[model samples]
Target: MTDIIETYLEDFGPALSGTISEHLEKSLGISAAAARKRVSRASGNIRRLGYVTFARKARFMYLENQFGSPLYWRKLVDALFSTNSAYGYAIAALIQREGFVPEWEFPIVCGAPIKQSRHLSPATIMQRLKEAGLLQTIQVNGLGDCICIVQSEEHYNSLAADTRVRLITENILLLAVKDWLRKLGIVSFDKVTIRSSTHAPKVGTFVWDLTAPSYLGCLIKTGKDKKVKPGFVAADVYLGDTITEPGSRPFINKCKTLRALRNVGPCMQIFIANRYEKEAFSLLKQNGIMPATPESLFGEDVAKGLSELTSVLHDAASHSLDPERFERLFAALGKIEGAANQLRGTLFEYIAAEVARKNYSSLVRMNQIYKNQSGKKAEADVVIITDNISVRFIECKGYSPRGIIPDTEVRRWLQHNVPVIYKAVKVHPDWQNLDIKFEFWTTGILSDEAIAMIKTAQVSTKATRYSLGFKLNQDVYDLCKSTKDKGLITAFEKHYLPPY
Candidate 1:
């Protein structure tokens, strides 16, 4: 019984009294009263179950050893995330890592489009987190309202101020680089994998302060005349005032890793810091890494703005507010927020692209926009042209592995996007002779009604000019692993795989 309860707590994270009884009754096929009694016994036995009481009424159940360790909060938050939706985990991870997030920007950071709502609204996510005792909404001195982790004052301040500043500075640098890439019009994959400081840096790995994979040329162009090359641009940011030779060991080692990966493609590696010693800069330059300052990468004005903004935001998170400084920082706020939002909400599209790139050596495009005669436009998340004889249009949905894709979305895809793209392709001079295959791909399940809608469309279109199909989480995983690319597999596991 103890082992069973321990396993349950480990898998589900800390649970309240009522939730514990509910799970026990279901798992053991026992009465509610019996389950409650068992919980009472185990919770009392300090040798087995560790329980914490909040407000003298709400009890949280967990393994005894994890209650107050340094990793306690991270583990608990992660466990809770595992049981929730993908968006839930994404939002939680972002907030917990940052330690403080502004209330207004929370939605945007969670991939919500400007002036539009995602499948899960920001308010709903916040409420859920509050109910789980993971976060709270509070007013900062000048930031209005901010969302922060729920912990004692001591635990919250235990993280060194320098470490906190470093985390925030790195995040700022990543956003600045992303904005720079977007301005250059070469951001192939909108989603970026930002580094987290929760663990020691791994050598010989692709993880960096910022990673954005982009194409060098136009993606919309077709036929034999068009040339598009794919590569990844990665950067590492140092927060210290200046990097001396001895202090540059970590960055130098990371540059070595990036050099080793150059054979993978034409990747651009950047080392960003406030300043670098002459010898250190020379070493980085000799390593084929672009050693730059925030001012050099982004103009001096923008760099100064970012530096001030980072300082102000860190101060705000630490309960020090400067309304005047915070207000002045808004000059560059729009671009930064847009860049961060762009870096999210498209994980699945990139995943689908990987599957196609591995399966076909022909022309593959992402975020392709097509127009009809009347100038109406539609965008396909991913497009692949194989042998110049078959064209595949893939629509990707980045939903939670445990969530369901809505029937309305499915209906719209089948009724609107498919027919429009099919007509557009059939009339295009470049694709006149190619067969069409339209596939709906998602990292989630489809309800029975939604499946029926898709199946009906599939059969009705069977004899038509284009074929229709779909790929769920398991289907995607099977195809991703089939590619035998370790990077692709790791991405699938991180973004698409079910926690269980």
Candidate 2:
């Protein structure tokens, strides 16, 4: 009976479970329940051999050997297109052309909000397609909700996490540039249109990071006759650590395409990043690409803020993430966008992780989320742990070099974050028989009250499972110097060290 069911299913690709069962019952003259049992058994066997299932209108077809197949996703998307051309094409264009589109903007891309009252609204169309498992929405940090195509759990997970982070990072840079442009009186926010991958036209075959059209010249405008200028402005941004030899050729090629497009009219081409190789820099200047850094473009303060935010975000992309915390981090990121000062604390966390890596010989993780048996959740900034040996949790405060650590901040770390983390560590099986250390590292002076609180907390925890310690600005600098890592030393001096 199972062999018969498998043979029947092999002939039909991706049929609903009920449809398969109904066919079995009618063809074999068996009861519905008996037929369903045989169908279930057959599917379970196929699933073990690289097949996958989905739930749409019902338990969707179990595809044979689709699980580990390189061509499976394309086949699945093609099937979706066969079912509904409009929604299918939208999904394909979003993934292939644009990469990903925020949900709100997606409707506009699809030529939505049709005028006639008789037809279904654009929102309704999207909602219906989502209900049918043709579309999926993943909430990105800072960027809000974004659209991707997937009908099953496996496919969703396969979409890389760094890809989403990269999208959010790019959008943040664009927003910053837009704000900077507005402040300079070059253009108002309303006049400027921030283009996305699919929304913006490609220059040759390259999709630019920034694309805008000019309404008037930078320094000239006729009051009586307002003539629209025929010109283009575009920028390409590199977010990698540094643009080196291997990566330089492709970038230069793309810049050449933009240069060729200049024949249509006057065009402004810009390149933005923190660091570039000497050769890459020369090539950019030779090709007429204006090379700009955050500091060069937006000044020292804004540049420092952008550098801190991107640094923390790059580190965050590697950790095992909790959905709630991920959302919070992104929300915090949005806040940091407006006020660069907000990134100091999060930025310090990454710096502290680097210090922990230099001092301790163990597995070090940042922004680790933990939950105890009673469902109490806690987060650790930097945790260094080796099974059955030791666990160190470090909380960081990234205030100004001469700033004072608040008494309330000290009180909470001792009173709240410490207790929760202790309980969380106790519940972990591998953390058994380990000595624990809890430390506060800050690039600021401690107030007298805050110092007393730390001393008291240390005395109280002396007999306990964990020990307590604190490192001020000078102490942190000394530890960093001990590491003898030139890059680490330079970063610490720039961000944390004080001038005498």
Candidate 3:
């Protein structure tokens, strides 16, 4: 650890505004700007600060603090980490032990930004420390961010005043996992992957929300744009250096509006969620958040867009379709609308993702596009139009083309039209191996009968056109594998049964 950072940590306590920079420069005689820039990463949570960039920006990033009281993160964070390889761990630990209190603090350190390399990684080092049993989780307020402080005595005997120096450095290797490794042109089938940096990080990409008082998230994507702006989409992403072991979903369910924008089609591309596009754009411009040019923000009119989508589906009632087909789309739209209303704030993304994951297409005033080179406008329950000759959708329970469309539904429906809209569409003989034909997907996750129906479908024009099946990609795990919260798991297992 640098002597400057060590001394600075001694003098520093919880932070707020320019107090951090001002105090550091005054005491250390360094440039004030450098101090502010350094300290923000070393101590602040970008989600709470609204300015410090950590990772992708989204409605969650923008609105995470709106509904809940800020966590008194010091206790929880303190309990979860121990000063080991960190630059100022010993000094900071001493100051914390002294119970130093800075008056009128705004929890800046809890929500600080980052601009450091591996040896200086604040977040990564902490997670690794926790995993190595150097940290412990304690519920301080009985149930809040004010959880317990470090279990100092737990490992006191395990350490010495002078432990092996090389061994200490070995503990810091996990910090490297926190660094974003840039890979250019990882995929050549389409556009290149992009990544945003700690400053002005992009939103709606994969993010890591640290459920603590110093709550911040690590926004990750494929491209090399290092700013946190909203309205972006990508898939096949996991969190960075999580406390959980490797291969877990490193993302939280962004809100409904953003959820509406993600297209988990067969290709699994295009993940968007930042309030609404227009609002996000203006906010980004106003906040000096630079996205990779042509950024789309979330619209403020999500509700209206949803209503219009339903009306279009309602219009389908009179189009060239069978009574059963009409019934399916109509019912599906109603459920989505109902689900949208029932979950106005939280889990909108979860519901939407579940719906999309179960089926690729929907019947709502869905943004239609050519599903393949065959020029067929794909439909949905969960619809996926892929570059490889295939197009598909799911049919959920009680949803059909002839169901009721609700009124006054708020929230903008995402424009989920496949990229090659109105272009040559290809169809595959089989969905996993479609040889070029329209693929109709309907509900299958709910019943064995539904899946069975798909296996015995007729392919001629005289057929029902839509099929039923329960097919999931290899990446989809039981969501259970992703979380390790004992209390949450216990509660879920105690009551709800897992879906087979």
Which should have the higher lDDT, number 1 or number 2? Answer: 1
Separately for all candidates shown, the number of backbone clashes (residues 3 or more apart, or on different chains) is: 0, 0, 92
Q: Work out the TM-score per prediction.
A: 0.35, 0.48, 0.20
In model 1, residue pairs whose N, Cα or C atoms come closer than 3 Å (at least 3 residues apart or on different chains), thus clashing, are none
Q: Candidate 3: how many backbone clashes? A: 92
Give lDDT tens digits, candidate 2, residues 259-360: 454334456667777777898688778877787787787677556555555555665444321223333444444443443333445556666777667777
lDDT of each: 0.61, 0.59, 0.27
- What digit string (tens of lDDT, one per residue) describes model 1 on residues 1-500? 66667777677665655577788999889998898787767743223222222332434566766554435555444433444333334334344334554454454333221222223445665676677565677544223245666655444434434444554556767777777777776665565556642222221243455666666642222335565445667676765557654334444544553455423445667778888889878987887778888889778776887677567645544334443454455455435744322222344566677678777644676666665766555668888888767899998887767767888888988887888888789898888888899999988789989888888887877554888999888998999889887666775676567897
Best-matching candidate per TM-score: 2
Better of 1 and 2 by TM-score: 2
Clashes of 1: 0
* Per-residue lDDT of 275 in model 1: 83
How would you encode candidate 3's per-residue C-alpha lDDT over 1-500 as one tens digit per residue? 13443344334432343544566688778896677666545522323233222222211111222212223234223322322223123213322222111111101111121322223333553454345333333312101111112444323223221121111111121111111111221222222232221112223322221110111132323334664322222332111111121011111112221244443111112222222245433443343223221013223333333333333333332221122432332343223323322222111112223334333433321222234554333323234454454455322222222222221110001122222331322243344444323222211122444333334433322332333333222112233224443332332232222335
TM-score of structure candidate 2: 0.48
Indicate whether candidate 2 or candidate 3 has the larger TM-score: 2
CA lDDT, candidate 1, residue 61 = 67
